[model samples]
Target: MKENYTILAASHISGVPTESIRAWERRYKALTPQRLQNGRRSYSTEDIEKLSLLNKLTHEGHSIGQIASLSTKNLKNLYQKHSPQRHPLAEDLIKHLHDFDMEKISEIIEESKLTLETRSFVLDFAAPILSEVGILVENEKMTIAQEHIISSILRSHFGTLLQISANLKPQKRFIFTTPEGDFHEFGILLCAALCLSRRIGIHYLGPNLPAHELIMATKMLSPKAIILSVARLPKDLQKVDIPTYLKEVRTHTSASIPIFVGGDGYRPRSSADKGIQFLPTLAEFDKMLENFTK
Candidate 1:
């Protein structure tokens, strides 16, 4: 049986303009629809679905050029791996840290075997545990030097995983950096480890990148995605000019490349914000990547 879709059918199904669809085919070489004997272009069911997902992501601020390159299977797989799981370890890790129980932390680390297990231990457990340690420091429950001891241990664990994952295959380029004055990189490094497991190439820019440098780097590398880590909300974020900064990057880029904003700083806003997508946590960002491709 032959399945076919007309221009209107494709438009209705994809929520993309028929003319824009045609233009994409012409300019971007996104899809190659067959022409029927009567001279109308006919799309297959697979083509329609791919176009639909592509349209959704692009409309939500991803680039069409990036979408064109992603296979539907990869897109679906990416989303599935990222969906949330019941991470009890995360809760337990926090509890232990609040009590300053070093023995419990050491015990859990010894019992965990897999890399994802370790990742879960660190992200779900250790990271939040560290957060509690910070609170303890603020209240003078723990001294600065003690906090450093725990922090160093967590960094060592993260570094170990990163070193192993770096040896994997089929690397894709990822640009990671914190915005100016936002010196936090722990979360960014964790996210990088996850990307590395999938064999994504990483070009971590570390902390405190100037906005202009970020734009310049984007222009230079033209990476598939630019992950901007906002560890702490800038004072400027409260001002109106933040939107202008976001728009500047959008105007400068020719590709529909996605700009993924993550960290504790930015809250999720409505999709209509134009250029930015706010992801509250690494877990949420990981889930969204399941459907993201290009």
Candidate 2:
């Protein structure tokens, strides 16, 4: 029942030249369009979106040869990071943050909550703003205190959203939390928000929980899965060893319950960790959740 577009239609919609699309397809295997009975190429809606994203990134100076292989989700994230135009509301919020207008900041966030759908508010609005604020702090354009203030505001709002979503009919329930010493929680908070938006129930245990305590919680809850976000690196790897923590949790918990880890802190091992799946992006996580429900 899905519509298919011809190469010319795909080009018109995606803004990529037919020649370039073919070249990317042949050279980089960027997309494999279906061949109709007459041997004409047919592209689906997803293919068109991917082409559009590729066209945008390529125009922004990315090498097609380099980026053609990246997932559409990664491509979108890259575009978000490199785009010249920031989201208007995010830009306004950032300006207010610089002025330290606490009241105005709260008002803007509350306004966003009311105006945008839960998913858009979290992923498209709140996520980007948090990421931009981190950059501001790194460049010293904003202080740590300002960063914390906005984080606190977003966190409080997310908590309220979580409670509201908890009452929805859940497709699956997962335990969401951050490990000890990984106090940076926005990544997990955003993930939790994304999950909740889809009626996925989250048993959110707040940050800085020790490994053994996580095992105990897992045993008690027996959730569909356990998801941890390790966005911030610990000062001492020896003290907050990810491999050790994962091994401990795996050994103690039931093998039937899968463990998913996300964020920048944990790297995928050369040999993938047993009984664990690493979802590196929010888009990928959402896709996996879709597959789970199906």
Candidate 3:
């Protein structure tokens, strides 16, 4: 059961103006608080979190009307993409997510990028921050929607890095993408960033790619390897099983193209495909890139 907070309490905790909250609730339908015995409105924790995000985004120039219909995940991702900058500590970063302090959060990300090399940037700052956020999300201390904001910000950053390094000489050819139904592509994007920093030739086909599409891509491109990301284990293994998909992919491509599977949700079933191999973490993936390309 969730605790219900009064309008004043929600406003205090979320740092939102009471009238503004009421206006948003009425106009945007941003939140639907419960009515008390006296017909007074009361909010839940999730309601406050959602309101906080809405307030932050609107403060950054987003129109409440335009964003009114967005899902929580969509809202967070929107905030991340457009948020401005500030330098912050790890603790500050975590706090900012709840506080919805986009400027300070943006600053910390930009500062990390400016100061660190690609590998250090990823291993030192990106990885640690994400690891902390992941734990919080798992523990229910942080909302999944808010975490997507971090992913969106980093995804934009890494995409730029990959693009900038696109003209560099190729060390090896690879195709990076997530399997169908696994909408999570941040893991592969981060990996591609590291790969690009090393001047490796990478063709990144972003998330939600069906197996047939991959087969077509493999045949057309003829890359040295096909790297499929299993970022989030399929909710239904019967329909979207990684190993099954890997085997199906293997049947379409030549035996020459080695298939690599990875990410947090990657769990090969008991009877797995022989061709598809799993790399447990980015550290392991980095080592493989070093070994394979060298």
Candidate 4:
């Protein structure tokens, strides 16, 4: 059976706005979507692929009016001509992401790991893949369950990667986790992967580590640094104030141990915050890693 998608779903999957999709269809006849019984537009998988190609070409400087009626094969040739350096697996992985084909997704990830070096795999492939899936989730194109499925697969692979690298001439070690109220793990997981690629030993404590427990773990592990990821929390879901939480962790932990925090939910709200380093992006975190090694 062929799959059919509503205009909104097509927009989400194809990275084209609904307004643009309609404009292209109406003005240029770029696509001819099927009309449902109630007269709503429904796109097919093929239509989405064509739209994705068209979107890519338009962003790369092609005029929509000039290329709207090209065949899919011709559009793909144009895409390659324009972006020859594009990762080979990206388009395939995105298709599988939308299709929810877990096996294919895992296969593509494994293939990329084998083909690219650790740093390249993380920067070029893994990071982009996670970011795309995250956008899909944020746009409501994918459900939380789908996000969890991808996360679980990535966590298992990254855990293994971290363990293998940490055993090989590891330098400074860092403890990675989220606070008690924050349950998201993807941010820290990617961070840990980057650290591993740099041969930085990581004792990943996973997410939602209570302040007290984190203190105890810190004492036992005595890592060179502590890294925390705090994702955005709805008001009703917040268990403790972030500033207070940071204060508690700082107070109990050794003053010498540097604490680095990152993610969307953290912003130093007041002057009381001290001894906490906020890294807003992975690039910043990597820079900190370089400083530690020096």
Scored by TM-score, the top model is 2
Return the top candidate by lDDT: 2
lDDT of 1 by residue, 1-294 (tens): 344778777776566899999988988887889998999999876777677666756655667776676776554333222323425554555456557788986665555534345436645556555665665686686788767766887777767766675565443577777776666777777777667645576777777777788789988887778887665454665332344556666667655778877765553333334767666556676676555533
Q: Model 4's lDDT to the true fold? A: 0.80
- lDDT per residue as tens, model 4, 1-294: 355888887887677999999999999999999999999998877788799889989988899999999987678667654563346686677678788898998899889878987666665666666666676687687887877776777778887886686567665788999999788887888888878867788898999988999999999999898999998787679887787888999999999999989876765432446999777567678888777777
TM-score-superior candidate, 2 or 4: 2
What lDDT is reached at residue 24 by model 2?
95
For model 1, the stretches where C-alpha displacement exceeds 4 angstroms are 1-107, 113-119, 135-143, 169-171, 233-245, 268-273
Q: Please report, in order, the local distance difference test score of every candidate based on alpha carbons.
A: 0.66, 0.81, 0.75, 0.80
RMSD (Cα, Å) for all candidates, in order, is 15.2, 11.0, 15.9, 12.4
* True lDDT of residue 41, candidate 3: 96
Clashes of each: 6, 0, 2, 0
lDDT-based ranking: 2, 4, 3, 1
How good is model 1 by TM-score? 0.56
Q: Tell me the TM-score of model 2.
A: 0.70
Worst 10 residues of 3 by lDDT: 81-90
lDDT winner, 2 or 3: 2
